[model samples]
Target: MALHLYALAILMGAIMSIYIPMISQSARVMGAAVMGNVPFFFVAFVTSVVIALVSGQRGDSFRKIADVPPWLFLAGVMSAGIILGATFLVPRIGTGALFVLLVTGQILAGLAINQFGLLGVPAQPMTLSIAAGAVLVIAGAALVTFGAVT
Candidate 1:
């Protein structure tokens, strides 16, 4: 199960690497970042409905949806913001810089989430090694984002 999870993570990474560029290009072609999200979410909503129906857990999923707090729905808002921001920034920053910066921000947020057990995540107290690793990641992001152009 753990190996499968790792593989899924890698797969997600690959998909996202392509997904951002596609979003970027679509936004450029459409001449509006916000416009890109219309079809994007339309497909996302349809795909989610299909998955729910096919998974045989639609009832359970709907039941659990009611259990979630209203504030948690802000995640959808945040998702829209993230997608919009990515669409706008990718063309300006280029994919490499955008990805590195995004990963850097995610790592920092992950650290906080782990430390505090935020959003029901398991608490994992920060250690020196973890902090050092975060530092190294930030440095790498800096190099990738601001390094001299060839």
Candidate 2:
């Protein structure tokens, strides 16, 4: 099940890679990158509602919402900030550079998260192999962002 979820995450990542560029274009057309979130969240909200209803868990979900600590809600704020930043940066830095940097950042954060088991996630002590992989990813990001075009 974990492998299946990982595969799905990879697929979703690919879709998001394309989606951000489209959002950047839409932001260009709409005259503000932040404006892109209006339609984005509208669709997200509708889809989430439909999913909750379809799962017959809408009431349960709503009830459980209060069980969540207030700090957990910051995830939504972080998500909005990410989308808004991507919408703004994609146009200026190009998708390749932006995603390279984003992925690099994600890898670094994941390493720390796994290292300390932060946010209730299971701890995975950082190993030499993992550290090397991160170093390579950072190097690749540098190449993508700073390398000269031929």
Measured by lDDT, the strongest candidate is: 2
TM-score for candidate 2, residues paired by index: 0.91
Instruction: Supply the TM-score for candidate 1.
Output: 0.90
For model 1, the stretches where C-alpha displacement exceeds 4 angstroms are: none
- What is candidate 1's lDDT per residue for 85-110, written digit by digit as tens? 98988878888898889889999999
RMSD (Cα, Å) for all candidates, in order, is 1.9, 1.7
Question: How far in Å is the alpha carbon of 122 misplaced in model 2?
Answer: 0.6
Q: TM-scores, in order shown?
A: 0.90, 0.91
C-alpha positional error of residue 27 in candidate 2 after TM-score superposition, expressed in Å: 1.5
C-alpha lDDT of candidate 1 relative to the true structure = 0.89
